[model samples]
Target: MPFTIDNTILLFSLLLFIGVFTTKFSARFGLPSLVFFIAVGMVLSKFIYYDNAALTQLFGIMALIVILFEGGLQTKWRNVREVMVPSLSLATLGVVLTTLVIGVSAKFILDVSWLEGMLFGAIVGSTDAAAVFAVLGNKNIKQRLTSTLEVESGTNDPMAVFLTVSFIQLIQSPNANIFTLILSFFWQMGLGLALGLLLGKIAVWCINKINLDSSGLYPVLAMAFAIFTYSSTSLLKGSGLLAVYMMALWVGNSDLTFRHSIFRFNEGFAWMMQILMFILLGLLVFPAELVQITWQGIALSVLLMFVARPIGVFISTMLMKFTAKEKALISWAGLRGAVPIVLATYPLLAGMENGHLFFNVVFFVVLSSALIQGATISPLAHALGLSQGKKSVVPHTLELVSMGKTNHEIVEVHVDEHSGADGKELRQLKMPQDSLVNAIIREQKMITPRGNTRLQAGDTLYVLARKGQNEEIKALFHQQVTEQDSANV
Candidate 1:
């Protein structure tokens, strides 16, 4: 049947339903959800004639903005700060090294020009934030390892973006000034950082000061500013993606109203964007085209996984305190996702003659990376004795709603066997003066706390406490209590 607005909506909704449903199988099989979502797009490609590259590009950018912004929101400033130096080195120098190595390899394998080969390298250089975040979900991985990977993935995109755009310009005009390009990269990144900080401060102030009748509108206000930050930054010749992530990092770490609600809303929203991004990318290509470059794609993928990425990690972390195994895992964990496929579209849109080849090859590399690296990261971590094991599943959750600025937060504390408060009555525990046990959850059941109710191992406590009392309250609940410690409290 011919397309109509009603039928379009019907078809789109059906596709989304299938995409969301695919998550179950993804979890069951221990595969990245991107695999299923992209497969759905490819299968649908046979029945649906959606080959609009421009539309895919537009949607991809919007999706990345939301995804990165949500990433920033979830990241803790202290965690990022601790690993800042090494992560930056990986994001910048690692990307450049990876690009050069892969570029040189592709030059020989594909018989392409140095610049063209490097362009392909630049396209796939950065480890994707979406893929990294998804694979590392709630894993009991060591904090240092997790923080390094997360920070690196979040910060590396701008470098890849710069390289891709610059190489495209050079490919078009071989005589373009190298110094001018270098200056441009610094300007874009510098302005992006400044704008992100400025807009983040403005956004937090607005969210706290503006009292909307409906609580829901606060998130809407935040969403609006997020989009504006990206577009406005790009319009001024800055790196919009970096700006979006930076703005979110600041907002997420700052004290503000509806902070928890804002995070919850964006988390769901970001998932939606991820689904759409992969599917759209999947729809943009023909599987038959991928077959033509199977050998070449696999060659580049192997080179990237075995040689390029490893070299990048080793050289980048050579001075850092990471162990041999940690660096090795970091190398293997550099899985590609939507960002690469999104970046591949740049060559096509920029009028590169072999753009389709670039896109198909990048698509193949991502699929292989996700399947190979994504599937094995957990087991490898376990094998290396770096896995912290999975965190406990807490069925019930609590959030504090704030209509204005407040110092109160609902913090979750787990009572393990080692905790001194595990067998003590609620009234006997010496919590901070302003803190209160709001509720307790055990075995998925919520229980109202009474003065005489005893805490048990495996219980989850929702404690409402002042902002600065987190360490004290957590220690009271989780640490071993001695006679002197109790007396001091």
Candidate 2:
């Protein structure tokens, strides 16, 4: 069952089926699906002889883009706004601290050169998007806490990437000056930010202004532009990863036509990419090499879990208002995934002397993180009294979009069981100024809203509002919501 042309399609389909099917069982057992995905890859690895650093790196980049784009689409800008400073610090300073601690300690523990140790540190510094998504999907938590973690995991990859590449360059060119490296970092990030924002606005403009016969073409156009953002930014020595994410953030928060469809499509696609990347990385491994790095792997894993991760979380989030419990949960939630394995391939592709060792050590660290941290996140969140109960919602109406150009948005807002809109008259809801309630669909019938119309649960409001008042409208209905309220599930 090696990954080759013989029965290729059959093996591919089988892997996908098995991988997806295991998720249900994994969820039932409080096990993260990422761990299962890697396990599937590792099991298939026993039968395959696949190893190519360059090819793995290429596919890994594509997977990351798709994953990050999906993450951006779902991330609400409002949720991230209050947590921005802390998230930014976590993404940048947290990554640096983790790298330094792990790198410095690796020199003593793994007996590697300072450069090699830092390279290892840089590869595994940030929490993984896929890993976080999987574990957190099972738990119900406060929105602010969830938002902080999600934003950090989604955005930190770029900083981790910058450090890895910079350290690699330093290894290759020993005379690389500190000033040059610092300048390069700022240049890459600044240019990436400018380009991503510009492209996102341009993408929205094209989507709204351009009219194609088929609605499908709009999504195609958006996808093409997103790919262009990453590729073009990379060509200019900018952070393509950061650009893709920022582009996704802007487009996702915008009120675009057929956005619901696009969100669903990208989510499914991200999962597909995750499955392929994890299994492929798994299939690409040689068990003999993993065996050889056992003691070194254990030592490195302990240091990362105990020392590097806690320091990164506490110091980075010090200025923020996170409680001691929240910081503890954050530290314990930093699970690594396929990203580090993919990054480890960089050394191999660059012809570094310890590339093999780097890959093996990274594989061990990822395995340990997924098993240890992944297994404990839910229980730990509960112990810290941070886990909120999950609530299930049924979609009552489609987010309908009309044809032709329009600046106004028609949103279907759900009235929670105890939300202010639950019993208050329509006028008392205190919605944003200039907002209009087009119709209220109760029990499968439409009622034209009036000042005294009493709202209730299971009532779907067809409210018309200005394009930028989404958060405001949502606030009007969430009056009774507590701080422990989970996201709009």
Candidate 3:
């Protein structure tokens, strides 16, 4: 077949399908699905014409926005509430610290100038939410640990982006004052925070009130709102990525119509974005350049995964009560994905020092991080004894799409013979503040639940929880804690 435009489409279709299937066996080899995507891009780079930096940068940004928004949507707020300070600190201060350590290390190891090294460090600093989320979707973790990792990855991007852009500007204008840059940092983050919260609330309010006739339209509406959040915040000199993520988080947690459908749609959307992004990024590179940076790239990758990430996590959680084992797992969970490669384009676009080399190095570092860190998360979690094994999610779920804007979820949970739920009265389950057992099904018969009613071993629970309380509601039907619940991730 002649490699025409039609052939190109067929090629991509085949690769993407193959890529999706390949992830099924990714854990066996201890490699993330992203490595294959990049490898595919490198293999095809010789056959394709993908030398447009500007276009690649544009698409990468778009993909990242969607990816982060999807990260927000999948996250459950209630799970993270208790660990808010640790999560936020890791996202903000932890990112800055990691960037600095990596920048200095890269400068000396790579023999690069300070600005160039800082730019490289900043680009690769934040843990990629796409990688973490994709990996953890298959992971069996405790709820708090899962929430902490998700929130850190989701929120840290703005800081990394800020540092990347700031370093680029410094290189361009050698006379720029350090104090001014510091001020700009705070200004951008502050405005982004305020606007993100405001826009999130506004979007949620509008989404709940404007009951659309078609359920599918709700996802479309939510996507449009996400785009608006990003664009508007960026135009106002704030962190658009942060704003978009915050907005999605609020919408996901709110009493919006068609909430379940939107979540499912966005999850699939996130995977597609990851595919497009890694493939495009792969096409942008020359495989030969990667060889030049191999040893150096591997060294930097090791520093990032083992030294910088652990130090950042430890410092960020200093005031908290985390076990040493949990901290170790958190450190290992830092998987770098396409975000660094995407940020690599910033230096290239800015015509900064060793821009091409930086891009290639960042690319290799990401591949290393994903291959080394991504693959090891499960094993490390197990070895550390921090792996809580999987929680009991409501199997055979049947969610009722917002009969109309209400902040409640209809969840169906099975109470197996081993579950703690077997003999507990409704009030003794200690469900979240507003959650209730609306009904029960036992022996193929439905029964309306009352507060004093006792549950049975074979009962199926019909629960109504306030929105974003999926974690809280699941606890009611979970089996009693046992020592041997091995993690499957």
Best by lDDT: 1
- TM-scores, all candidates, are 0.94, 0.88, 0.85
lDDT (10s digit) by residue, model 3, range 363-416: 988988888778788888888776766544434333566545566677677776
Model 2 segments beyond 4 Å from truth? 1-6, 391-397, 401-410, 423-473, 479-489
Which sections of candidate 1 miss by over 4 Å?
Answer: 392-402, 405-409, 466-472, 475-489
Top-TM-score structure, candidate number: 1
Q: Write the per-residue lDDT of candidate 2 for residues 1-489, one digit (tens) a residue.
A: 355686898888888898889889777877778778888888877777688778888998888888878788777798889888888898899989999999998777777789888988999998888788767755787778877888888878888888898899999999989798889899999988899889989988888788777665666777787789999999999988889889999998886766666777777878888888888888777777888889988988998999999999999998889999999888888889867888899899899998888898899899888888888888888888998766434221234455434556666787767565577788876678887889988889998899999988778887777665766777655544642255455
Error (Å) of candidate 3 at residue 189 is 1.4
TM-score, cand. 3:
0.85
Better of 1 and 3 by lDDT: 1
Give me the displacement of residue 274 in model 1, in angstroms.
0.5
Tens digits of per-residue lDDT, candidate 1, 40-147, equal 889878888777878898999899888888889888898999999989899999999999999998888888899999999999999999999888865667888888
- Clashing residue pairs, backbone N/CA/C < 3 A, model 3: none
2 against 3, candidate with superior lDDT:
2
